[model samples]
Target: MNRLRAVPKQRLLTSALLLAIASPALAQVAEPVSPSEATELDAVMVTGIRGSLTSSMNLKRDAQGVVDGIVAEDIGKFPDTNLAESLQRISGVSIDRSQGEGSKVTVRDVGPDFNLVLLNGRQMPASSIEATNASNSRAFDFANLASESISGVEVFKTSRAATATGGIGATINIKTARPLESEPLANVGMKAVHDSSVDNLPKPMQGGKWTGEMSGIFSTKTDDGRFGIALSGSYQERDFGYNEAAVGGGWYAFPGGEGPLANADPAVNATNPPGPGDIYSIPQNLIYAINGVSRQRTNGQATLQWAPTDTITATLDYTYAENRIQQRRHELSTWFNQAASQTSWTDGPIAAP
Candidate 1:
């Protein structure tokens, strides 16, 4: 009976210990760090803030973004230079180029429309949609947005700052020089350029070559008053050339076929080719053509800035562009006879036996 009573006491103690273990509040608690330790962490955060501020200020002072910037003086030194070519130096920038040297700049693999390219902080309106036609592609002409008109260009890579809020891919800002508040003076500039294709293919116009540009800047203060007016304008033209080859192949449907090859065969005449309303073989190498494209563009811009006082300013700007693109293409093909000995080439002589 005494042993049985001891057992009951032991069981009671065990149950109480288990209950305490399962209770969350009774578990061990960790102590918070002391004031000195917390202060040490604050120091690290302050250092990081200072570093970031320094970087931001540097970017602003240089008239650049964290991503990139290009100055007009730099562009003046290169050959066949243009706005798109200048912007290509920035990291992550690419070009949506055609056969011609002319192209639109792309940022970080994004489409040209995704970017917001501004002239003096204002959006430039598009002149056309077809991009290749000068009359149609005039809205974003590189010539109208002259490299000379730009004092500098800034490419914003990220939207970390308030100024970079609207653009997602990137913002290209073209800065223009400010008119002087003091005595004004006139400045004049002229430029000429020539470009020839490296392909060296015989062209109707000898591989497309051309040159043209005119520019002037005038500023003056009233002889007796503080009022001043300034005007600047530029005009340029270029001839672009390109050669392109295109290859295309598509499937052909046959009568009572499960898959595309159910009744497919290389047996057909050119008179009734495989196309809509017909069932026939699809020749892989049916047509081969080389096309030559040439274009001439005339672009110009005018800007006027007025600063009556040190803090008051006004500006007006305009752009005009025209392009004419012409294309000439010839398709050549060879047809082999059933005997394999008779061969005929389009635009070429065939020996008849």
Candidate 2:
């Protein structure tokens, strides 16, 4: 028996400093400090790739179950273009690429549909045309969510008591920025996207221009720390094309290298004859198709938090993403319904034409 795992299987000290002086005659109990009398320590903010990696390492060490994560170094600043690309950095995770971009993810050996995705601990609904079952749409498309507004992503490989249910393979939680956690700031970004695949197509079918991407985020918190708000949105466009030439119905094999469409005779049909136990196969159809595809993805999120007390907080957030696709296809193909005048093949164990 063998086990499968290649990842090299690679702490809280709380000490209360009590400044108390005891006298022999009378004993005075140390009074707890009130909120007004307590000293407020300055908050330490860490940013950059190293800082984010440290944060991820700390989370994994402190978590109760098998877990991994990626944290953003700063607000609206993630290393990858989208969430799906970031997830691929984790061990035991793979993604399905669409048009040179990541779409969905597979955790461990399980498929995408069974993996659960959550936004700030709330269940996120996903739908796809690739779904094998119509009854449920459980696979979330990571490409739909841009990385600008995201703060961090956590992947739990094992089921835990507090997390959401129905993640047979793994549960992924997407954490966004909150008013209190994020400092008061406003940021905007612009990017130019150019895909050479579109330009490589026929001049008539090509989208000859480049696309654009824009994102902005604003976060604010009240001076009293009682109320906070965050708003972020991203818009991205992609112009790409897919050209494929392949066999559609696959090849059908014939025993003894003879079928209704082909004969085993080397003199008339092929250069080599088929042995008694040899086999041959021929393609049913030859297909060549070209498609010009355009895609636009929009993502927006608004979060509001009210922290009436330091220990108790109420958070309300709404996240929305829309993906639109337009495509034009031109295809040229041949179906093997009519026999050709002559087809030839070289010498081999089995004949082919």
Candidate 3:
């Protein structure tokens, strides 16, 4: 009976060891994992005017040279219609509006001739048909480019090896938006403008009419975010005018007691001399001028970007801009001449067509 009891005890000891070995495997398969213990992820999203301001500040801070920049507030919007007008917000920058519109930029007291303008790191063709003196130097016509097609504008105040040579005042670099910069972005805008001067003018001037503008932008990227494309277009028309008055031609001055002509027979002579004084002449011409201007502008841009890997990027961009301007001037003049006596005068008002 004692031998039988020892065998039973040995079997119990073996079973206990087996149970201990299997307990760990069962616990591993039955326990559940909490979702909070998973790996962490990161995301970034920016939009609106605040986003544009932040992006512009970042660009200025990270630039290798002294630079100022302006970023678009949205898909197809800039601060102003004329690029030069927007640039005036920068320090030490000024603009010239000879044609009643901001057409040239002057940086740090330096004229536009010394400043260079670049379109995507390349020199753009010059258009000066409406420029003052028809000057086509290094300056660019800001009116030709529509603000909606641009993504950003950078003004380089200091030179760098990577930058193009030739700007003493500043180098302007205009950049177009890329599709990868945003997620399936699209925008459209239209505006109708009325000019009081043009609308209130008489019948003939009424032809100037009202003005309008239309602009749009579209951007998309591939599912993998490796290839992208952006397209933008804008059309604008404006009618404006200027009114001016001035005095024209020669002047006649005499000492005390001396008349304007010094003679009465319509010719200068000693016997018929009146008096010597500086107050007799009323013989001169007065002029007035009315100028009217009309302009039409169209701008478009297309950009394609390809990134096969995270470390490399390739881009192709194309831009087109056209501006047509029409101008007309009408002048009216009046002449005053000496008649009977040296102190006498005649008046004739003449209109020029």
Candidate 4:
């Protein structure tokens, strides 16, 4: 399985040394640190990038940050494969995960809604579902952003930055890679991934899942040297299941002269009226709950770009995503009274009719 694990104590110290020397935090671009100052003998290093197959394949034992910015490949070395997952490695960052998966990112224990997410330096859209069960507000669905097309990610963890003044927690800026130098070729590519497990749910529950994605890009320059056109599209699909636990029925009433009796006297009979010996009680109903949840999701997108002049560019893009969930739930209650038949004046076994 493609999974990320927490950094071990030994690896933390070792990887820190390597990362401190190579990470962008100490690099010359965003933050400058000379080799002398980064000469830590013990430090653990982990990559921040997760989706660059080419970059990851070409990584050297000591290679670090790139010239452009902080790529996911730099953070990919740790166990995280998602934005929130990778961000958790950063100090003071927390997450409200779902089913052990990265669902939302929180900084310094602050709620996710307090944070902001940006795509290509612009606000995308917020999810209508609340981050918690309390209010109508919702969390930003970071999963909607395409990680494969991402070139780099910038995080403004501090509140003093002008660009991050919109939100209190932090601001996440996701950037897509543009043409390296105005390539004229018709670039087309596709990728697919599948995941399966025996027991995705609790005991007596088992299932499997698969997901795939395809995307392409086409660009060309007009002969007049003043115009250009580009087109792109992408599609994706996924399937998964869910499970839960519950207990039912807290109280119950028993037979009595009027309603119910507190204690069993065993000394008096029915002629005694609503006194002692009129009631016997224990946990009334022993019930068990069974619930099942399954869902399927699909998303498609198309984009167009045209540049009539060197400094003027116009672009149009549209995306559609749909998800369906099929769920089945049931509950059963069973309680046996070892003596539901026999009856006696003094609470003794009745005659064997």
Best by TM-score: 2
The runs of at least 3 residues in candidate 3 whose Cα sits more than 4 Å from the true structure, single-residue gaps closed, are 1-44, 129-135, 246-287, 333-353
> Candidate 3: which pairs clash?
255-277, 256-276, 256-277, 257-275, 257-276, 257-277, 258-275, 258-276, 258-277
| lDDT score for candidate 2 against the true structure | 0.81
lDDT of 2 by residue, 55-166 (tens): 8999999999999999998889988997898899999999988777888899998999999999899888776533335536568878778899999999999999999789
Model 4 gets an lDDT of 0.50
lDDT of 1 by residue, 108-196 (tens): 88767677777777776654323554453322545345554455677887664546345567887776544443236465667666766
Model 3 error, position 92 (Å): 1.3
Residues 163-202 of candidate 3 have per-residue lDDT tens digits of 7899999999987788877778888999987776665344
Report the CA-based lDDT of candidate 1 relative to the real structure.
Answer: 0.54
- Which of the numbered candidates is closest to the native, going by highest lDDT? 2
The superposed Cα distance between candidate 2 and the true structure at residue 224, in angstroms, equals 2.4
Rank all candidate structures by their lDDT, best first, as comma-separated numbers: 2, 3, 1, 4
Q: Model 3 lDDT vs. the true structure?
A: 0.78
How should the candidates be ordered by TM-score, best one leading? 2, 3, 1, 4
Report the poorest 10 consecutive residues by lDDT, candidate 1.
344-353
Q: How much does candidate 1 score in TM-score? A: 0.55
Q: Candidate 4 — which residues are off by over 4 angstroms?
A: 1-69, 72-81, 89-91, 128-135, 159-165, 177-233, 246-294, 300-324, 329-353
lDDT of 3 at 69: 91
